[model samples]
Target: MSIADPAAVREHLLAAAAAGHPLTYSELLGRLGHAFTRPKMRALCVTLAAIDEAAEAAGEPELAVLVVRQSDGLPGQGWWTGSWERHRFTGEWTGPEARRLIERLQGEAYRYWQERRGG
Candidate 1:
């Protein structure tokens, strides 16, 4: 699958979720045969947003939560701010509070996909 294919990306994220691990943005880009570039990262974020919308419609967890920054293991600013309405967070978007929120979301994705796969 290529980076341009949203479906393929979704599947890739689902696999990551099932494995119960989050991936760095650079790691995901590398898996898709691309380097870390701002434009490419923005494009990926677009795809990830679409994936999350579809997943939400299908009653699944947001798969994009599995992709995070290597520094803090939290998603990028776009996710924290843009998707804030969907989440019930009220604290700062850093430190332990933010980490717990991301971890909880990632954990939900992990359990959902893992159980669905009967693994």
Candidate 2:
């Protein structure tokens, strides 16, 4: 799903994915070229969680972790500074961790995001 990219970026993301680590809030501040508000962060989290579900459905356990592609909407950065996500740990996920997404997604807050917007 990723486009052709520099070898360095690819390397960074691969390594980060294996480790499941995200950048801290301090780190994000220095590099943020755009926005990462609370609402935005929450939305992104839901989207990321949805990605895990899709990967599980696809049977590609190895490829289920969206955190591996953790960039500012740009995959492959070796760091998890994607918006407000930097404030927390949503940048990586291992096979076992993928199952947790379902439980989290079903939680009260996320349920609202998954349902119809107006309703």
Candidate 3:
């Protein structure tokens, strides 16, 4: 959609998500264009990647932990659901805690999905 305003960009993303047409990595890049090229935005993307990597580091079981970007429907632009609840985050909210957030979510998901063989 090539929205120049970040707020507008958020709105479009929300609408698209509602329609089951959520943006992919490349699609979001192209649509937002330079709007997210600023230092903070770039840092946030980097942080998200690091979070994903850290979550992956927990091994195959944690790989099933799904991470998603909230599109205004949630409290933050970045979000993940644990076995118990949902967590939402934004760069302005906590720029460096992405890794910990994902790790916690991975733990929760792993625990939630683990097979109960000994019961």
lDDT of each: 0.87, 0.34, 0.40
Off by over 4 Å in 1: none
**TM agreement with the true structure for every prediction:** 0.94, 0.30, 0.29
Model 2 misplaced stretches (Cα beyond 4 Å): 1-15, 18-20, 23-33, 62-119
Instruction: List the candidate numbers ranked by TM-score, top first.
Output: 1, 2, 3
**Over the stretch 3-77, how does candidate 2's per-residue lDDT look in tens digits?**
112232223323434444333322232233325454544433444444444544754332213232233322232
lDDT of 2 at 73: 27
Q: lDDT score of model 3? A: 0.40
- Flag clash pairs in model 3: none
Error of 3 at 90 (Å): 19
Question: How many clashes show up per model?
Answer: 0, 0, 0
Evaluated at residue 6, the lDDT of candidate 1 is 89
Better of 1 and 3 by TM-score: 1
